[model samples]
Target: MEISPDAIIILKWNGIHINATIVFTWAVMVILVFISWMATKNLTIGPKISRWQNFLEVIVGYMRQQVREITQQNPDPFIPFLGTLFLFISVSNLLDIIPGYQPPTGSLSTTSALAICVFFAIPIFGIAKKGIRDYFKHYLEPSIFMMPFNIIGDFSRTLALAVRLFGNVMSGTLIVAVLLLITPLFVPIVMQILGLLIGQIQAYIFTVLATVYIASATRIENKPNKIEQKEGSKENE
Candidate 1:
């Protein structure tokens, strides 16, 4: 059985091969774009909103709230990047129910690409919030000797993100495929449903982790003033 959508070639011309991963990834993107257009083309603040619009608003609101809670700051700036990550992954995984449809996220390359985006986004958001100098200064916190370790930590976490997503997605697909071969018909069906749940969960986890990393990068440490410390000490006394 094919372990990755990247191995399934759908087209070939002039020594170039197009795989299922590319096709399905584009398919998911088109579906999202089309649905988004249809839902918002007639957007209104009035009470007569469509169901799709209402559903999308709820999702967006939840995401914004989560970001707010995590960063303790305005969520507007981070929503576009983080929202797209959540939506893309969630939709990709949710569509696994369709027969013969391979989720692009099942591919290591895709997950790695997503992880790399988060990796770079960390510094970008950090630098934007704290300025280039202030952001990089944290890597040397307490001592200049820790700079290499801090840098390594960043790369390690990025690698973890990629492997975590890729392994979960690929394993789920593999389990369903193997069950279909040896198990009864109903068994595979049940596993498919479970796979769907796992997929949604993985998407949520990936998004939450990305949000946390970005939040950490952008967070401002507000140390209490000496006056406040004295006031608290006096209160205790």
Candidate 2:
């Protein structure tokens, strides 16, 4: 059985090959863009909004709330990036129920790319909020000796994020495939439903972890210091 979408080449020309991973990833992107356009084209402020608009609003609001809760700061800036990550992975995995369709997320390369985006995003968000000097200072907290280990920790988490998503997704696909071969018809159907649920969950976990990482980077440390000073002044008075 084919383990990865990359192994299924759909086009070959002039020594270049296009695989199922590329095809499906683009397909998912197009679908999302088209749906988004359709949902917003006729957006209404009154009580007569379309169901699609209502559904999208609900999703966006929930995501914003999640980001706010995690970061304890304004959620507007982070929504676009975190929301896209959640939507893409969730949609790609949800599409696995379609027969003969391989989720691009089942491929390691795709997951790695997503993880790398998150890896860079950490620094970008950090530097944006704290400036380059202050953001990098965290790596040397307490002493310069810890800087190397802090850097290694960042790399290690990025690796974990990629492998975790890829392994869960690929394994889910593999299980469903194996069940189809040996199990009766009804059994595979149930597994497919379970797989869809798992896919949504993986999307949530990945996005939340990313939010936590970015939140850590962007957190302002001055508040606690000020609170302590106030307390000390009160004690002195």
Candidate 3:
């Protein structure tokens, strides 16, 4: 029934305290890293593969495909970042089935931190792909008058991303809690299943939005490249 994991303070020192969000976030990271290591410890390409290796490969391939479809850029470069984001959020959402666990994602702080990461990543990826000059020039698109608006758009989008995730996750947890209190058994079970579905959808959505934003930032210059390539083809013909 806790709204935020901040309610669950694990330690206090010098008037500072570590909360459930921090603890659970760390737990999620450790669990994910450990599972990955264990699963891929004996990966092989010799035809006879372990089920774990197969499962890992399938998941990785699916994520890579998703990145490629979204960005139209090389997926390998983006996979590690986007893939980890999707996996962490999805796994955090799925873990809600465990009794007496509060998903760290239910916290606004955590979601905002994630959103901030994406906000910074957009510029980092854009600059790397296009260059700092081109990336900044994008903010002045259509005219210099739009620069302030564009900067505002940047912050507003980050806020939206964070709030969107926080609202979905917190609302899901709230609904489940109410169901548990009222029906307590059968109804809550069904809601739990539905919540899992919603959680996964949210994960995909968050990842796709992130991919789209990065792609928009980086791909602006590529349009001219395509046009020139087409023009060159016509000249050769």
Q: TM-score of each candidate?
A: 0.91, 0.91, 0.91
lDDT (10s digit) by residue, model 3, range 193-235: 8888888887887787777777777786656455335323422
Best-matching candidate per lDDT: 2
- For candidate 3, the C-alpha RMSD (Å) to the true structure equals 7.1
Over 4 Å off in model 1, which ranges?
222-237
As for model 1, its CA RMSD to the true structure in angstroms is 7.3
The residue-level lDDT of candidate 2 at 33 comes to 98
Candidate 3 collision pairs: none
Of candidate 1, the 10-residue stretch with the lowest lDDT total is: 228-237
Residue-level lDDT for 128 in candidate 3: 93
lDDT of 1 at 172: 86
Candidate 2 wrong stretches, greater than 4 Å: 222-237
Tens-digit lDDT string for candidate 2 (1-237): 788899999999999989999999999999999999999999999998999999999999999999998788999999999999999999999999888889999999899999999999999999999999999988888699998998997998788888888988999989988998898589888888888998998899889888878887898874444433532342231
Error of 2 at 100 (Å): 1.0
Q: Which stretches of candidate 3 lie over 4 Å from their true place?
A: 220-237
For residue 230, model 3's alpha carbon misses the true position, in angstroms, by: 25
